[model samples]
Target chain A: MASTRSGTARRQYGVAALFTAPFFLLFGVFTLAPIGYGGWLSLHREQTDGLGLGGEPQQVFVGLDNFAQALTNTRFLGGFLTVGVYCAVYIPVMVAVAMVLALLLDSAYARAKRFFQLALYLPNIVPGLIAAMIWLYLYTPGLSPVVDLLDSVGVPFSLGSDAGAVGAVANLAIWEHTGYNVIIFFAALQAIPREVIEAATVDGAGGVRVAWSVKAPMIRGAVVIAVLFTVIGAMQLFTEPFILMDAATTINDSWTPSMYIYTLTRSYNLGGAAAASLILTVVLAAASFVVTRFSRKGATP
Target chain B: MSDVSTLTRPAAEAAPPAVTAPERRDRRGVPPLLSKGIVNGILLAATLWTVLPLTWLVISATKNYADLYQTGGFELARIRLWDNLVHLFTFGDGLYLEWLRNSLLYAGVGAAVSALISVMAGYAFDKFRFPGKERWFGLVLVGVLVPSAVTTVPLYLMASDLGMTNSFWGVFLPGLASPFGVYLGRVFSAAYVPDELLEATRVDGAGELRSFAQVAFPLLRPAFATLFLFGFTGGWNSFFLPLLMLSDHHLYPVSLGIFTWKESLAADSEIFYPLVMTGALVAIVPLVIAFFSLQRYWKAGLTAGAVK
Candidate 1:
């Protein structure tokens, strides 16, 4: 009996391993190994001999020098500030826009909800790079009707300026994401128990009042998750700034963290780039931890 | 099972059932605190804001180089959209076509295989008990947090060391292991596939692999489709990794190709500018079509990730 049971257990183990082996192999070799390799790369520096002109640069061990340099690098920290300002502008504006649209769609006064939903969710289909490209054209002076319209309205708009760069990038992100989040917020609103809204209605709560007081609060979990995910996603801000750099003269190679890393790679500073990548990963991992924890709490209720 | 049904439900029939109650109340006599005109007006304005850039892209695609420069974005001139597309296709001995083909190959093949790998792992996690299962899953969850951009430099380093840089394999290989997809797959397997079905298949003398292929995988189709669409968009949207790995123009995805074209615009604005505009439109058309046709899957995918 013991031998038979052991045979069954062994068979189950073999089957399970067969099922899971492909994922583990790919994840380990591609994802896990790179992470470990990046850490190792982060601890070394490439050094050249004899005026640095002839031989291949030998990678020499460097003890925390890259991290120290990254810590003190203004361009690196400036990238963080750029992203911070972006998040400051982006998160509230996007959430508010999405929330308002969702509430309006959920309201009794709205018509053609499906049409509106599809219309709004359209931009999410465009790739981020393409979205940035589209916006780049729109930000162009003579080519853009938007620019023409602003010019005609007596508003000076130059995407090349720092403030303009921030606004342009933020607007591009807003245009791309607002409608998608609207769908999310709208779905969360739909999932709210009908009785609660009715109860609020019975208490003489007006439409706006009930939307703000009851509906928004009830879907607060979704709102929180959306915000947190947006924050995490914001850290990967590369395509927009990378594309915008061509048009916006003020935007440079190291204008964002991902851009900073890319610039490092472009200059053949792999160790420094790897260190920056590790720092970014650690920050993102912490944010992700918060997301997972909050998500679990959100799921429970 | 119910989650799958709701996810797969036709959009027309999926309207909020609770909408009628409020509509009835409004008709009975409660004055809306926000005016009807105001609410709809806000929505209309929001819709316009969302639709305008796409509309601009379409209109801009139609203008010639001269008209593109001379005319405003909304100005409709002699329609050169077809001409521009021809130019885009025929440019530099058909470079754009190569980019498009590369994109389709990467996104299409990469997403399909990635989804399958995820589903297999997810099925194992959900249906089987094993030593160190939770620990392995925790590692995957950690992967879900490691942003792909951060890993790109390291991946590029490792790939170059392996002599795989500037090749399709470098970009293609990394995209296949999405930990989030694995996580979603586990959730889907638990929700959609019952262990009793697997047990019955076992009793019927089917092998483990055979049961998974014939019995469980069929039920996991919705999850698979959702995962595929998610992977598809991700692969399609991926730009940085390819930008790092690929140097040969022939291997460039449409996104990177377009960026190269845009970069050249500073030198030859008259030629590359119109091409970039038309190229952006062409590149997005497939994705737009896919999104519309597979709207349900994307919606389901978004909610799954968001809720998780």
Candidate 2:
């Protein structure tokens, strides 16, 4: 009986391993191994012989030189700063809009909640590239009725200018993301016990007061997660600006850190690109850690 | 606060019955009218804000190029949507169809295979007690936090090394490794799949694989559908990876294909603009249908991800 039991235990382990093998295999190859390779690549540089293109390029260890160069690169630094401005505008607006929309949907006074929820989430269903494309036409002068209407009304609404271009991209991000976060916030709102809300309403709290004091506090965890994800997303802004690059002159080859990395990779500056990627990764990791830790503290008591 | 509660107690009890008639008129099934107008008005504005661009896309796609530029923003000058669709499908040897096909293949096949892998891993993690399980699961949690965008550059480098760049496999293979899907699978499996059933199958002399295939797999249908939709949308919507990996236009997904057309509009706006708008419309149809039909699953998935 002991031997039979041991055999059964071993067989279970074998079966478990078989079931899990594909995930770990793909994860190691596509996720883990590339990350390790990127780290190694960051520490090395490609050196060429005389005339800089004559012979086989030699891979030479560069220690921290590539990282230093990446940090000082004006375009990379500018992209980082650009995203900083973007986050400042985007995070607060998105969180606030999502929270407001979710609250309104969750409220008793709001009619046609299902229709509103689906309508609001419609943009999110559109692919990011397609969303960018749709907005690209919307922001264009001759093609956009918006531009024509604004021109007729004499509002001078043009995304051709530098600040206007940034605002246009921010608007695209806001439109694409608000619905997704709204759904999350709405879900979180639903999770709040009905009795707590009833108790608040019975205590004579008005709509605004109940939403602000009761509903908002209760879904703080979802709010924090939304804010953190938005921050991380803002740091990775690429496709919107990339698709809009031709529409606006303000958007250059390197409009964000990811764009800068893309430009570097396109130019075959692998070491510098890898170094920059690592730096961005570190920043992202640190920000996520801080947000999670901060939210955890807030959640406890 | 106590004084306020006491003062409002009588009013609160009296308000519900008083508000019932108006509540019956209200579709939201709530007993409040003071804020109804304000709330509905705001919601209408928000809905318009969300929908106007899409509505514009549909309307604009129906207009001829001349009418699109000449007419007012909201006016339907002429109905040319069918003509635009024809031109879109037949343009450049039907490259748009090819792109649509590529997207469907990439998203469809990638999602199916990925869902299977995730479900299997999740089931294993949930049903079996194994050494180092917690440690392995922790790695997956870390994977969830490590944004896939940061890894794309390295993935590109690795793909180039393998000479898989510009191939369908390049995009398809990396998409299969979704840590979030695995996490979801585990969560769903734990909630849905009963271990007692597996044990009963085992006692019935069923092999492990057979028990899983016969007993557990059927039970995981909802999870499979949820994961499939998640992965499908993810793969369909993916842009940066395919952009980085694929240089060939023929291999481009709809997102990248439409983007290329949009880029061409910069040089010559008139020719490609309508084509792109129409193509954009076509690309989003499947997703919109999926959104409307599978809303409950999406809601369940979102709340599941959030609460965890």
Candidate 3:
């Protein structure tokens, strides 16, 4: 028994070893190490006296202060609130629009699906900076064709105020991401067994009946996946707001935990930065786990 | 092919073919006009929404601030493109070009090498046997869930400890290790590689590397293309690490460079708005080209890295 076990072990070891290397080494150095080290760094704060300069800042262990501070910080609070509101508005619109597009691509009248798929999905591939630039140009005074069209029609419009910033940013995200989700949903829609649809048609069901009764159930997992990724991403929402900083002026520095960390790091508060990062790490991990648990459940059933 | 249309096309597409065919015969057989009209209208609107802002990027990249402010965006006018290119390539000691180069290098080399490493590792993991295999596989899965953003500060500290901070390597070296690649390699090997082939090669006395190179590697081209494209995109799009690691403008990647440009503009100065716009547009070209040409690989790539 032992010998057989040893032989099987050796075989598995040799085969698996080769397959895991490139990823393992990279994952270890670039990924796992940083996470472990970040945890360690978060346990201590650099003690600084008046001016926080002219004297050496000593790293001293002060358990939980940094985490507590980060948690209670008003800006962090506001940032979280802002992003939560943003996600509330962003996720449903993006996902619903994507599903609708995916359904359209799946429909009969649409020609050149490859063209539409590529076109719809193209915005996703555009770098965030470029996407921001394009949107920012449209949002800026006199540079906006929409504003011009609005002026030509004499309709009052503005994308500058607090009420408008989230919507404007959300609009960019919708443009960038809807196509991506649409493809996923479209693929799911594609993966639906044709026999099922044919059966529905034979049963005298119209397209709406087929979609609501049969198609929707089958694509639920994909919808969940789209939602999961969007949610995970929505939780981290940084680049959009970061680039739109000009418009988000009333947005304040700690518009999100990420921004908060950026601010702390910029202020040269390494300890605080480390602590805030650690807190974010924990929150994100917890959130990701919950998403994964539900998504896996969704994927399987 | 027939199934393709029925499965993937949007719902209002539901009406078009039926409508046209029924029209040829009679109006009695057509589905409701509202469903078709609503679906097409909404879909076209959505597609337009997706396309418009990005369209502005190309047009904005070509125009000067004068045209931009005057018209507020996009002219078919063939002006300022050369001037924008020249300025973007030469501005402030030509740092924008350096960032672009850094991004290309990071994406090109980092992804290529990482793909090779993942293929080898994945192939081995699937085909060969070693100790602690399950443990290692589990570790990789955990690593997959771990976002790189969480590791930025720790990584920066580690780099500073190694005296690698502010160097191009500081930005690029870490990119070479991708947990996702290894897992993907594993998935590809499992799905595509036949154990019998490996056994046959062994029977013929091909060594491990020889079997992988001559037999297994050929089977992995699709997977490699997928891995390379994904790895390249991720590397190119990465920003936080560069922000944390490099202070000197010369060492920046396009993502970090744009952020810095944003910050500079925020410093209440006249700012390099046009140059930044031009630079942002230039930064997207490589990704756009990569996606258009490599889209086939992209679908396969997503399955391995993101989906399954």
Top model number, DockQ: 1
In terms of docking quality, how is candidate 1 classified? medium
Docking class of 2: acceptable
lDDT of each: 0.84, 0.83, 0.73
How well does each candidate superpose onto the true structure, as a TM-score?
A: 0.91, 0.91, 0.87
* Residues B53-136, model 1: lDDT tens digits: 899889988887788877777879999888888899999999999999998889989999999999999999898878888898
Q: Cα lDDT for residue B284, model 3? A: 81
Clashes of each: 0, 0, 42
Candidate 3 lDDT by residue in tens digits, A1-301: 2335576556556655555555666677877788777777777877766684597777788888778887788887787788778888998888877776777888876656787888888887777666776676677656688767877897645665676778878888888888877777777777665756765666567776777666766666566556766766776677777777766565566777788888887786766788877776677777666766875575444
Q: Indicate whether candidate 2 or candidate 3 has the larger DockQ.
A: 2
Model 3 clash count equals: 42
Model 3 over residues B1-308: C-alpha lDDT tens digits?
Answer: 11212223333243223322222322235667787787777777767777777677777678766566655454555577888889788878888878878888988888888888878877776777676666776776666656555777778888988999889888887888766677788788888889998878876766677888899999998888888888787788887678778888877888888777766765632347767777787888898888878988777666334334
Q: Which lDDT tens digits does candidate 1 get at residues A1-301? A: 2335577668888988998899989999888888888999899998886675677788899989999999899999898889889989998999999999999999988988988999999888789998998899889887787888899999989987899999999999999999889988898788776766776676567788989977876676677767877888897799998888878998999999999999999899999999998887777777767766775575456
Q: In model 1, which regions exceed 4 Å deviation?
A: A1-8, A51-54, A152-154, A286-301, B1-34
Query: What would the per-residue lDDT of candidate 2 be over residues B1-308, giving only the tens digit for each residue?
Result: 11211222332332223222322221223555658888888889999989999998888888777787798667888798888999899999999999999999899889999999999999998888788988898898788877766678889989998899989999989999888888888888888888888877877888889988988999887788888888888889999999899999999999999888887876877778789889989999978776667676887776666654
| Share of the reference A-B contacts seen in candidate 2 | 0.59
